[model samples]
Target chain A: MAQMKSANVRLEKLNKHYHRVVAVEDVSLAIEPGSMVALLGPSGCGKTTCLRMIAGLVQPSSGEIFINEQRVTRVPVHKRNIGMLFQNYALFPHMTVAENIAFGLDMRGVGKADAGKRVTGALDLVQLGKFSDRFPSQLSGGQQQRVALARALVIEPAMLLLDEPLGALDKGLRESMQVELRALQRRLGLTTVMVTHDQDEALTMADRIVVMRDGRLEQVGGATEIYQKPASRFVATFLGASNLFSGKIETRDGAGALVAVAEGFGLLVDGLSNEAREATVSVRPEAIVVEPLGNGAPRTEVPNSVVATIDQVVYRGFINHYYLKLPGGSEIIAYQQNRTSEGASSFAPGDKVIARWDASSNHVLPNG
Target chain B: MSGRLEGVGAWVLYCVTAAMMIFILAPLLVVMSVSVSDSYFVTFPPQGFTLSWYAKVLQDRDFLDALQLSAVLAFSTTMGSLLLGVPAAFALVRGSFLGQSFLKSLVLSPLVFPALVTGLALLQLLSSFGSGDARLNLLIGHIVVTAPYVVRTVVSSLQLMDINLEEAARTLGASRMKTFWRVTLPQIAPGVAAGSLFAFMVSFDNYPISMWLANSEYSPVPLVLMRQLVNVFDPSVPAMSTIIILLAVVGVLILERLVGLRRAVAI
Candidate 1:
């Protein structure tokens, strides 16, 4: 059944300008059939603007939107046949749960008997079958969110749009709903686009993540590519914790290049272009290894190693983070997983430590 | 010493509030007392208890005509204000347009304008437009005086509503009109009912506007009562005043039941 109704969307050079401010600029993306894509960014980063344009609530300044190869940029919002779950759920306060879910089918001119069956099925899918007669105010927050999801799905729209769907939920509920919503989407093979500022939500649910910044696209890739190989400094910082080292290229070696840091440290990195004069290198915090100075260990020594003092230590449940101050006053963060057998780190604040990473772990970024 | 001062302040506040209540209710109470008087002349104190004055006032043809005219005018004003004011409130609150602040002030400005001035202006404008009938002029005057209350009340309710509800409706395949009728209208129904009631009462009890616009033969109930108070010393005058007071009280109670009294007044 899912294979019979696959959904595809193609946005072509979409631009939305509100008076003097350009809300979304030249954004073009193709969402594959039966996959979830997330537009991840901070507030005022144009993620919501892009979603609104796709929902046909905001007209683009210049672009064409195609849903299943049909241009729908000029279509009226109601006539577009799309479903959206608002951040606040937006269930009709006066209507019961069943009536809210039946609203779309009724608007589409479906018969009462058929609409009732679909409403029941939709409610059952969301596990709210018995609460169909309750008003929105009578339900819990989580139940209301599910009813909103059910209402959107009952229409079986060509594509589903969720705008910060879990923003109003508590932390634990948000995490659980992320898993539940992802499973539902996969089970139904519904094409979905979600707008969220949370990196964890994007990584956990979306098959592809489009990171936006300042009303423009920063990078669009799978979770691993976006995290492991960020195209820019903003993407690297926005997606996760990364230690950025500013350096100038000194020379080129076989399959690597040498760089000179400001703090009297020379390092070699892999995958650096020969013509690159200066670069900002990003290394993930978890990729760095911290040890006591002068501890003899054999590892790949092609990259940077900094002698630094541990400034602060934050212990999360499964990991410990160390903030290290390098010789040149630059700060770097390193994360170490807590193993059951290994005790906690002996290094305290103000203790000298050697922070090291392999050359291949660093990705050279263009300075902006 | 501080505690003693607080007690003294509380007593003073209670006295002031009681005085205000008596000041506001004095006229209505006097009219009620005079309506049951057995004396033939209208006065503050009754000579004796009787209902014959009420019966006499109720049967008078001129008084009935004035009462019917006031009712018709009040009903028409309420309907007209709702039709005009609700949409104006929606536009002022929800729409993003240039001069929105200016437009809002313009809609509510009639509240601050003197009723006599508005009545005179409407009378002049209507005569220029070839409307010489007293009822038409009075209807126009009442609409002008009452529209601001409707606009203000509806706008207050519109501000409290969640705008995302309308967006959600649109996303669910509801057209703009359907979204309004199904979602926006229900949320603001209390305000709409309260505003119309206020419009009706203001038009019904208005004197300054009716005096300037009404012809001698077609005066509203309030204007007629005022004329009787000036011209005659009959007990029927108080009886008629008592009836008018009761009608106003009923209108207020109905509004309070529809929407809370506190909200209607605050809005």
Candidate 2:
């Protein structure tokens, strides 16, 4: 591993339009050096387009890009000195693993002897030293991905861009490789930007997550911050399952505001002003506590408590999901982790239950 | 009853395949045998299997000159077609512009047009300009017919290639020329080789085109072979045919060794 200069990348209002269709619109962000940030979004959400623009594969329609404070908006892709791993890995089928890894060095006009040594070092870095003689077709999918990773890193690039790096692998391999890739990226101290639609991969690997939707940034924050306090309904639903409640604000308060959903149905929300007339709040499924309402135990009145009937109960291996229907005929899901067999809640469909959460758990999405 | 019909269908398929193979190979086998025959005249079941005709054909001054001329013409035509066809294929497969499809059809129309008519047209077109170079005219005519094969094969190869490989090379610091040499060329070498082999073989044995384009001073092997066949009915003619056939077989085998024949001809 050679010492790499981690670059600070900044996109200044990057916009890409293919005729009338806007691929990416007004995307501006600054990426810190040696940190992994994920552009998380669904397909056709312009995450891949943004990454390609950064890689210089796609030119931005009307914006500038800077790498390490130097403008590169018009720089050609080959001269950018960036390492990119495509979704398909893009290993040259005609070249052996060693030769594939040596391609970048060869392009840079590195001497053959030195290139061979570095290729060996890169192979060992990815733990594929023994398979250097094999072609890409002979390697397994995971092995091919590792070869691609090694090839990208061998160039000692300024930054690394990954487009769905683990999307090709099976579930088990994908999880393991996510951890492995993150560790390798950290060890190299290379600034990396990865584009992935899978939220779990973003959460597990990236230090920051930029949630994108419809060519715009929905939210940008740390994984836990974005998950717990999403800025928009799109972020709340896109990242994970969230129970949403939309209503009109009824009262103003210094600490919290109350939102009225139906007649006599007021939901207390914490940390909000009465500036907006309408508001939408989200609560995580696991954050809500579900208890049997009509049992010998009396139900305690809570700030965000709502008496609902369980519409369905789904038993996932490690957790149980309760789909509850509130009095206003809106459906909400609550997840209860099955820690132990004796402590697992045994609620079935049509069972009367009280679904409640603290005021702090109810996050008001400002622009929802 | 359906099972029996399927069995009969399978038998019919096998019979048809065998008949087709024999139909294709029978004349070739007969010519090969007659080339080695001991008789003065061309005879099949090849009298005593002598190699005298092969030696005698090799000694003929007219055949030697014709062989040299055809060899040079075929080699030059292969090179010319490759030079023109490869870039044309790249343009056809990768470029996007108005009338692209129309241009594609126009480039490939030579394959469907009768070569004899093409030769006649080229003769008229070249003569109208008073282009007196017979060999160059013949070369141009042969290239018009053979370049389409090169373009077609290379186009199929380019189409089947994964585009991401080139992108990866670019991201790996390869310039456009470097990427083409290191990634694109190697990937499509099989198709290029196959196309060149086709051009060489087609140009070497071209009769209809050569019949219109060739003169006494610049006659190619096919014309000389045809003239020999008409003037003298001997094993020497079959011997010369065997040599051409052997050259074609050797070319195919060399191509197969360089890149698998299955891949080369897969298009």
Candidate 3:
């Protein structure tokens, strides 16, 4: 009934080691109060291990977790007062919806009358109030997720944790639940951390995304920022599709740098120096513009442009996918937006084209 | 037509099943009718129906003592087996340890072992330990035999249950013991109910084990019934057996009402 204050969660140099395998490595982060951050990574990347550690379900090899500036590294899971929704929803089969929602309060020694009122409030919050008397098995998958959401929210936890909360739903329901869960989280202003390998879910739901790789933090930024400015080759590829090129930096300036990939051909890429010469440069597929060869040098000065022959053309409704072969025996894909009435069939095979983009589109990663 | 042939086959199958059911139960019906016959000796299609044999068996002090002994033994055996077997089932189902399969085989071996062999083994094991208390002897023997059923049903139930339910309970702030009571125990109630009834029936009707473990002054109902048949020539033995069968059938019915008998046995 009352608005609960969200708490800040900070992980200080968190590390989890199982035998010799590192699950999470030197991970440090600060989650602002009421903000939702997603730990996004591929499977076995320790995204789940970090979430479990925060929930106090797993012991960290070496780390400290603080909630609202209180150290909780040694706190048991039950005393942590955190709510977690599992991937399977995991609602108790034998209990009714109201009982499942009120179990946390009941465990806290709350009075039965008070628990009933809050359970009713929680059921209405998830819009499952009428189904309070029904068992979990009687409800559909989406309804089960909503009831699980109610169960997690009724406790008014200090921090809410979700382990792929909507992964079990169908594609349509998963998209809708993602929106509903985000709205609920925002409305309650509950500081939340969700672990998900689906990049789309993280981008759609989290305020900030922390990408991980091989049990280490790859990059941490906002969804668009992470996509536009990936910190490494792995992050660039892991976040989305990319076309990478190896080049030698020819010149450097305060604004950007010039990188030469082939003979007499240099692309002026922004935001790089001499140190970036040895690193690989990534260009997003959608960012590349593919035009027919006879168009001449564009009326507008195009900075980072390359000469390539079209190998294959795929019509995918909204966009035309042109698989282009660069002169250096490398292949890069360009997704041309289908804006006119012609749609994606405008491009065909064996057409020589200049794939170009702005200098700012070049993403340089340091060589390891 | 093939459809007509299938119909004939189905009719034959139903007849065969019914015949098998009667084949198994016909002797019990004979004993029951003989127990109610007015004839002095055991006979079917009796001269007249009377309950005098029931009164005669009820009046027998040895019969009453044996009934009380059997009831106590059955209750204790079921309780002990559940206490020991449920946790063992959990460990076997959830625990990953060296020799896990071996331990499972060891616990379940009693199910396939002959009751006479188990009885002999228990007598030797207890006598080797130099114990003379026959009630304790019978209690231990019954637990050894009956616990496998509890273990089996519980393992079956646990196998069918989702493991995430327990983890979800823990995340919802339930402690280990609380999670077990609130989540784990209720999911497996059918299997437990089934197992307890099986244990009770097996312990109550056991004869060979009770024969070897009988105390100097008393024995179980089954053992007493056997002794009556061996020493006497009357309808009272059938009367006692008929009462035992009725009690067993009633117990099965009550368990089926409480937790569906199909669910318990399916495990």
Q: Evaluated with lDDT, which candidate comes out highest?
A: 2
- Residues A14-33, candidate 2, lDDT per residue (tens digit)? 99999899999999999999
Winning candidate number (DockQ): 2
Give all candidates' CA lDDT scores: 0.88, 0.90, 0.86
TM-score for each candidate, following the candidate numbering = 0.94, 0.94, 0.90
Candidate 3's C-alpha runs over 4 A off are: A17-22, A253-255, A262-265, A273-277, A295-303, A340-342, B1-23, B37-49, B96-98, B128-130, B261-267
| DockQ pick, better of 1 and 2 | 2
What CA RMSD would candidate 2 show? 3.0
Misplaced by over 4 Å in model 2 are: A262-264, A271-274, A295-302, A341-344, B1-11, B37-50, B261-267
lDDT of 3 by residue, B12-31 (tens): 99899999999999999998
Lowest lDDT block of 10, candidate 3 chain B: B258-267
State the local distance difference test value for candidate 3: 0.86
**What would the per-residue lDDT of candidate 1 be over residues B1-267, giving only the tens digit for each residue?**
555446787899889999999999997798899889888787668788999988888898889999999999999999999989999999999999999999999998889988788888888888889998999888888998898999999999899888988888898899999999988987788889879988998999898898888998899998888888888878888889888888888878877775674334323
> Quick one: RMSD of model 3?
3.8
lDDT of 1 by residue, A264-300 (tens): 5767777766567777778899989998886565333
